[model samples]
Target: MYCKHCRQVMDNDFCPDCRKATRMPEADDICFLAERGHPWSDILCDVLKQEGIPFLRQSNLGHGLMSMIGQGLELESIYVNWKDWERAVDVAAGLFSEDVEILWDEEDELQE
Candidate 1:
């Protein structure tokens, strides 16, 4: 398949040129979108849901700490399948430009 982000001919599931998965992504192929605390995460999640973009909301804190301190207090990370990444990003950008913390440089790690 061809990469949606970068129209490169793909040899494997992931595009060699763009380093983005061109096929159906697995759990390991999920791409990080942003990190936020409490209501912000909830708001973004709701927007993603409304846009029909599948996503995963995970707490950055350890499970024990999250449980003890409460989910609201800990930072939450948003991840999305490679296929829906562009759309999810657009949604996030439209909603929160400055506050959304996206680790742009770290996206290269997904290629590995």
Candidate 2:
């Protein structure tokens, strides 16, 4: 498939190069959950899975570079469907301590 916004070939609804959704966001559309480096991202992914939440991890360094560097020097952006955002955020908060604030939205006053 091709991204309607960037006109680039895409394998899914999200445009990796553009770092945005290719189509209009539906109730189940993917949304950014968090951005973390290395071990944290890996840990978060594992926790999300244990809680039965579906997630996608996108590497800032791209697949080829991530394969080469193993995501050690870059951040990974985690995404979950809009329908799962609340649950995913709860899972994230439970995984981290109070001092480790996980901000889902700027206007959302709710921090964990």
Best by TM-score: 2
lDDT of 2 by residue, 1-112 (tens): 4444553434577887877777654556677778889778987997787678899988889788878877578898898876787798887777665566454445434543
Error of 2 at 43 (Å): 0.6
RMSD of 1: 12.6
Task: Point out the worst 10-residue segment of candidate 1 by lDDT.
Answer: 2-11
Model 2 / residue 83 / CA error / Å = 0.7
Candidate 1 vs. true structure, TM-score: 0.57
The TM-score measured for candidate 2 stands at: 0.58
lDDT of 1 by residue, 1-112 (tens): 5455643334488787778788644433567788899878988897797688888988889988888988778898898876787788899888786765544445445866
RMSD of each: 12.6, 10.3
lDDT of each: 0.74, 0.73
Off by over 4 Å in 1: 1-28, 70-72, 98-112
Clashes of each: 0, 0
| TM-score per model over all chains | 0.57, 0.58
For candidate 2, the lDDT comes to: 0.73
Candidate 1 has an lDDT of 0.74
